[model samples]
Target: MLQVFVFNIPVESGERIGFSTTLLLAITVYMTIVSNRLPDFSYLDISYLSNFLLSDVTSGILLIICVIQSLRFYHAPVMQQFPKVWVPDLIVGNPYGSNINLAENGRVVQFTNEGEAVWQPANVFEMNCVAQIAYYPFDMQNCTFGFLPWGFGVKDLFFNVVSQELMNIYFSPNGKWEITNTRLYSQIFYGDQLLRLEFTFKRRSRYEIINTVGPIIILGMLQVFVFIIPVESGERIGFSTTLLLAITVYMTIVSDRLPDVSYPDISYLSYFLLSDVTSGVLLIVCVIQSLRFYHAPDSQQFPKWVIYITKVCSKWKQKVSPKDKQHINDEQIVNSDDIHVPTASEEEEREAPPINWPMISGCFDKICICCFTCICMIRTIVLFVMLTM
Candidate 1:
């Protein structure tokens, strides 16, 4: 119920998601081979990569990642003779990796008379990558899987990408991110040939938009309504102050989500929040101005500028449209017989009260409500446009 009241996102009636072409999920791209540094050989296998842990994927700790891989080798006659060579070792290709962790230690799987061998084992690696969060919530992350021969240098062992196709047959899409693109390439790194698989993922923005941005925009527009609340009710300051505090709390929430980085990069969200805070402060100023005018003693007569403004506004108000004038005339003509002429004393008694500070304050309230409401709404629309960009 709290979620529905505070953060529910309403989708347009005709909104829909459509895909023009069928695409596969990421194919598992895993390789952890270890053995005696003997001869350069080509091995072929299909890898399955899944279970992306995004919560702690940042640089808070030097965490090690583990992957299970299935390996296959063909036309290796010498491996059949030396069963001792079948032993699996260690390999860490990630540049930020600290060490290699081994599990199941590469046990021999199958051997055929045709000189084909299979080994399946668990490979663990601890890696640390610097996070780029300047565009958070609307950010795209680039993660890579780089694997190469550990025992042999580029001169002895060669690596190549047989295909750049990522098999998506066994993978599920992430709830918060979508894989935008992928790349495969072979490169020589630190004298070792490496096969690198790169993944570009973009975050889904619906959560932040509905839960954070929506509230900011709504509260921003709501600030203007403080003027509409009658000052006589004594709720104007309380309402404005409460709104200012709410905006401050949301500012903290936005700040907490951002990382403290050594470099300078500002999120566009910061701009939106800054505008909201400014409006809140301005709202308090406006409220104070309105209250001051309302409470002023009648002895403190209106300034010349104030009197002039009210005179101009009254003149403008007296200039009625033709439709209103005709309606008034029709009513008067129909009720001519019922209308009783007022005496001079009655006219004097019915005269409007003298122009006072309280009446002027009411005028200022209308102006502030219209002006601030327009500003808040215009900026909110701009925010939506920028968010899409």
Candidate 2:
């Protein structure tokens, strides 16, 4: 929706420059431009009683989608004290426009003793605002329209905001976007007087988070479960491969749906690629290595690192409770015990048995499960953090 309301276009009353509405009307006649039809015009002028209004501003973000409503130019009485919104060197890149003419009919209101002449033309404006999609699903974009008064400079004319409202009261809510901020400020661009109307839109990212981010994270967690399957069953490799294939297919299907840039850059693109590849491909490699370790012959001796790992796992698993310890001591000291119990301290002090391939493989599986579970969890946490921040 264009912001349809009264605006103040002030002129320097003390200047000797002639401020005539007739000249303004002439330029208004030549200055017919729409978002598409408005061509690049070089000449400028400020006419008498010129009123610029925006109405029916309809916009949708994600890729900065906008529907051009109407850009109406009206004539009003002499300027009064109106509020001004001053901003520094603010710019909104470049927008596409064409040169078109504005057609107007003179309108006048008559009172009992006084009268005001109102001239306006019915103009239909079509503006197409393409979004900058760098941030994608979690992005805020500025859509701005700058109007310059022809044949005028800062020394000759001043532009100010008449109404404080930047948005139309009738604007409908958009499903993918919401207005976060607005600016109705004026500044000089080049040597001309420019009046700018800007709207900032933030993307509604719930859909992307639920659909795109959720699947990648779920796949990452599922990939780690392959380590739980016993290596002897020979299905660990198959399970990991199947998962990898499924993820590849899923990615291919959703490639078009993921918010990305024309050329590859950061934002969600990096996050998706890093998360999926790390969680998916890395686990597949771990499965292959685990199977190799599992199938090694008994003749093969455990490496020093493997021995250290198994020893760590062994001590961790060998904890005893006080009741169990007392029962074991009693049984070890008596011959007629329900069951003969070995001395726990003696077992701990004995020389370790020769390490075998099966023991190493089993230990390796346990280690992979523990490590990858933590990794997948960390990745998921990081993903959430990036989105929230």
Best-fitting candidate, measured by TM-score?
A: 1
Over all chains combined, what TM-score does candidate 1 have?
A: 0.60
Off by over 4 Å in 2: 1-93, 96-136, 155-157, 245-265, 320-323, 327-354
Please provide TM-scores, in order, for all candidate models, with all chains considered together: 0.60, 0.59
Worst 10 residues of 2 by lDDT: 62-71
C-alpha lDDT values of all predictions: 0.63, 0.57
**lDDT of candidate model 1 versus the reference:** 0.63
RMSD of each: 25.6, 22.1
lDDT of 2 by residue, 79-177 (tens): 222223222332223435663333222122222212332232234444445555555558677787665655557887787676544856767899998
Candidate 1 residue-wise lDDT, 1-389, digit = tens: 11112112222321111110100011111111211222344455322221222222221112111100101132234344433444433355665646552323555455555656644454554544455565656877788776655577777666556678686676699988899888888888777677777888898888987998788878988888899898889999899899889988998898887765645466667777888888888888988988998899988968888776655554455454323533355445454687799998675457434678887887778778878988888887876676556
